[model samples]
Target: MKQYKLDFNSPIGIIEIVGSDTEVYSIMFSEHDQIVNVPQKDTPQVIIDCQQQLHEYFIGKRHEFTFSYTFEGTSFQKEVWTALTSVAYGETATYKKIAASIGNEQAVRAVGSANGKNHLSIVIPCHRIIGSNGTLTGYAGGMWRKEWLLQHEKWNSKGIKK
Candidate 1:
């Protein structure tokens, strides 16, 4: 695995990407900010590609990212995150939608809990999930940052399937 940091604004302060040869393993905000365990290791190919794609995303030139990645989570949590990635940029999905998508319509609270526990941030796009009431709610990055991100996607992002 290869790990590197890129400075980014909002939720995750400095972003860290853990990569393999083919795709990113994880993209997390440097919030808890655990330092890279080994800086001497070669930069992983996945990390390199992910950063390039992310640059395009921040610049509003990209929408969907194609990468082979795996996340470790409960089967239920994994389901939630998986559905989150399907949510197009600038679009928001309610917790209710996430629960239903995963075939557990009554699991809204569980879905919300899992969303909070998501170690991967933007790559998983957990920030794109909101309350069924159509309000921003329960973002691990802080709701204010969530609002900023959604608004940024809504306003700045182009070349997307709108």
Candidate 2:
């Protein structure tokens, strides 16, 4: 498969969007030195759309993403990721909740593991999962970024911009 990459400057940090012409593969936070800005003309349309949607999200101008993406993971992980998408835009779920949603309530830890492996980041909304006690938990992008996302969604839910 032909893969394309692009780096986007977001409020939280630099993000790397990777995809093919027809489908997004992953979106991840890039280290300061890892980002390379690809000119718009050279980027695939899907990646450009992902970048634009991300920009809208950061600015609170968009709440939902409309793009095709392909998941590369175990079946169980894909199941967990699909469930993650069902989590409301401005709402949250616990790992336990996600496990239960997948009909494996006892697999909370496994659910967390699958979530940790998610590559789609904001598009998958893994940041929407919190601890059962309503406390924030692990986020690949750092807890501070997770907090920022949760707070951003919270503010957006209330029709207020932060």
Candidate 3:
């Protein structure tokens, strides 16, 4: 399937949303040092909807995303991603917790690896994953963005405006 793309100007920076007409594939930040892809004029409706949802999320008007997205990764990664959604908007979970949630308490490192492979950014809620010791860990979109997202959700969940 041919994928379409759109660029959304978010509070943190420009977000590149890629998807087909039916489901989103990726939503990542367009790093300043990288060449940003020009958005297609005929952007997919699902992607447009994702843009709207993300905008609402950034503004604290939305907590959950209802956009259609496909997990284009291994089954293990998909399982990890599914468990990630349960981490909740403001709550955080550790890799060990995620592993346990999936009935594999010893796969904490694997859970972390799967989290690193997530491509949907905030929609997947991987940023909500913290270290077992309650410290922030690795995030594919950079640790700073992960920190920002956690803080964003923490404030929004409390009905506190950022």
Candidate 4:
């Protein structure tokens, strides 16, 4: 499958948005400084939509995204990612809770591993998962981004602008 890519300057940093004609494949942070200037008319509709929604999200205007996404991972990882989506906009769940939700209470560490493997970042809400002790845990985007997202959601949930 041919994949299209674009770099978006987000509040946190540069985000590399890669997708196909039908669905987004991944949204990951990028350290590279080169920004592709894909004209709006030339850019894929899915990519355009994803960037717009992400912009809205960063500004606390959007609470949920409507763009379709394709997940690439093992069955267990996919299941874990799906469960991560159920975590509400502001609410969070522990790794243990996610494991139990997937009918594998013993897979707490496995769930954490799968969470770290998630490539969709904020769209998948993997940052909403934390350690069972209520402390922030690993985020592929880094702990600071995770903390910012959680705080963003918390303020947004309360109808307060942040």
**Candidate lDDT values, in order:** 0.74, 0.90, 0.88, 0.89
Could you give candidate 2's per-residue lDDT for residues 22-109 as a string of tens digits? Answer: 9998899999665586746767778888989999999888888898898899999999999999998789999999999999999999
User: Candidate 1 has which clashing residue pairs, if any?
Assistant: none
Off by over 4 Å in 2: 33-35, 160-162
Residues 126-160 of candidate 3 have per-residue lDDT tens digits of: 99999999999998888888999999888889975
* Model 1 spans with C-alpha error above 4 angstroms: 1-12, 32-41, 157-162
Residue 33 in model 3: lDDT: 48
**Candidate 4's C-alpha lDDT?**
0.89
Tally clashes: model 1.
0
Candidate 1 vs 4: which has more TM-score: 4
Return whichever of 1 and 4 wins on lDDT.
4
Pairwise TM-score winner, candidates 3 and 4: 4
TM-score of candidate 3 relative to the true fold: 0.92
Q: Give RMSD to native, each candidate.
A: 3.4, 2.1, 2.4, 2.1
- At residue 141, give the lDDT of candidate 3: 80
For model 4, the stretches where C-alpha displacement exceeds 4 angstroms are: 160-162
Query: Candidate 4 — which pairs collide?
Result: none
lDDT of 1 by residue, 56-155 (tens): 7777767778666788889888888888898988899999998999999999999999999887777789999988778888777677778877887898
Cα lDDT, model 3, residue 139? 87
lDDT of 4 by residue, 86-139 (tens): 998999999999999999999999999999999898899999998999999988
- Per-model TM against the reference: 0.81, 0.94, 0.92, 0.94
